[model samples]
Target: MDKKTENFLGIDVGGTHVKIGLVDTKGQILQFAKEITASLRENPLGFNLAFVEVVGKYLAKFPEVQHVGIGLPGLVSKDRTTTLEIPAISELNGFDLKSALLEKYPNTIFHLENDASAAAVGELHFGTGQTSQDYLFITLGTGIGSALILDGEVFKGVRGNAMEMGHMLSRGNSRLEPLIGRNGILKIAARMMDTFPEEVGQLAGQELGMHVLVGAASAGNSIALKTFAEVGEILGEAIVSTVRILDVNEIYFGGGISAALPYIMPSLDKTVHQYLSPYYLSDIKMQRATLENDAGTLGAAALCFMD
Candidate 1:
């Protein structure tokens, strides 16, 4: 058997569904499946048990796989053996997930990590063009997610879960997520449309969403442009603080909402350059991440490469 072609399992645990992929060392997904988590969440046996049971089913089906990587959405123990807190699935809090999986599959090696951090690892390994081993990764989606890569590894702070930029306090002491996340951006768009009805263009009398906002922005709608500008300013302010603390120059943005980056760039760049000094601004590199929808699955598999 070709050891290099050995299959590995990647599991991305989310609130609504769990995405599973059979990936090889080169990052190609050979097989994929998704399990809606509503039933698992409602199961009387509890989410932890239901989750384990589902994974076992996959393991039984892919008996040749001995390595499994699970990417979780919230906080995890520094030792990476237990889930400290998972907001989407509260039952996982303080659960010794590693032990549970081990009890069921004694011969397999299991790896766990924060989902955002896992994405960063995937980018480091699979991204194009001399991807930085050290960079700040930000995912703009339903919520803002962040991770720091230092010396080719996820930078876990003293407490384990580090680089949580979303929770950072921003304007008026509001959390960063509420100020610039998906909902936050939509709120800005609505307010802009309301403020400048004549400039609303395609957004006039329409249901607002990220896609609509991006589409309008692409079509040069004044309201859409204004909304993204505001979001960029707020997000850029947060990045300024993050860059100052972490001292990382290469920044990569990903996720569904990052599509608005072009619209947000004017204010984002202005805010970043306005506050940062010459030394910090000189080498700064910020751009969109290459991996898109596949990032989560690829990231889960990337966990197996971590020490």
Candidate 2:
């Protein structure tokens, strides 16, 4: 009989779609596929059961895979057995996902984690950089997601959802995500364009999307530049406070909007330095995460390595 080679199955469950990857031990994805989340929810058996049934399909294809990892969008129980308060998929809220998977695939071992934390784990395991044993990770996308890595492991606070920097209050007592997330950034651009009509260039008549803002910033549009500057300031202030509490110096930025890190850096750096003490600012490192678009898929795969 041929010796069974070790390979892992990774599932990244998002708000609208699910990313599945067959990953080897070194974090390389051998096969990849995507599924529409809503389509699964429409199954007669229900979302949870449909999800479990789908995994069986993958398992049958990769018979040697004995470990499966799943990355979720929201808070999970401390034991990692249940998903809690999932905003996007109301059906998954409080569902005992692990138990269901275990019951269906009795011979397989499963791992589950929050998507943000899973991404952090992916960085620790596969990212290209000076991977720090301790650091802060923030994803700047539709909603801000954050995770803390201490001593090369995810730091799950009192409840499993510790580093929620997105929800932290910032200027005007507003949550950080709402102020600098995707929609928030667009709103900023709109406000800037309205305030500085003369500075508007390519962005004036075009739809004010992040892509447009990024393109305009790349072309030296003054309003776009100013918009990112303000975004950096808001993000920086949050980092200043976070560093004070976590005492971590290395920070990684991911997500779609992070593509404009260059535009946000000057202000982000200035804010951190302006508010933080010499000790806190001594060796602060803020850079883009390496995985890029593959973060979610690779992150889910990285979960199997946690053990």
In model 1, state the lDDT of residue 226.
94
What TM-score does candidate 1 reach? 0.97
lDDT of 2 by residue, 1-307 (tens): 1113477888999989989999877778899998889999999998889999999989999988888889999989998999997888888999999999999899998999999999888888778877878989999999999999998888999988899999999999999999999999999988987899988978767978888899999999999999999999999999999999999999999888889999999999999989999988887899999988888888888888776
TM-score of each: 0.97, 0.97
Q: Which stretches of candidate 1 lie over 4 Å from their true place?
A: 1-3
Instruction: Please state the error at residue 247 of candidate 2 in Å.
Output: 0.6
Model 1 C-alpha lDDT per residue in residues 174-243, reported as the tens digit of each score: 9999888899999888888778888987787778988988999999889999999999899999999999
lDDT of each: 0.89, 0.90
Cα displacement (Å) at residue 66, model 1: 1.7
Clashing pairs for model 2 are none
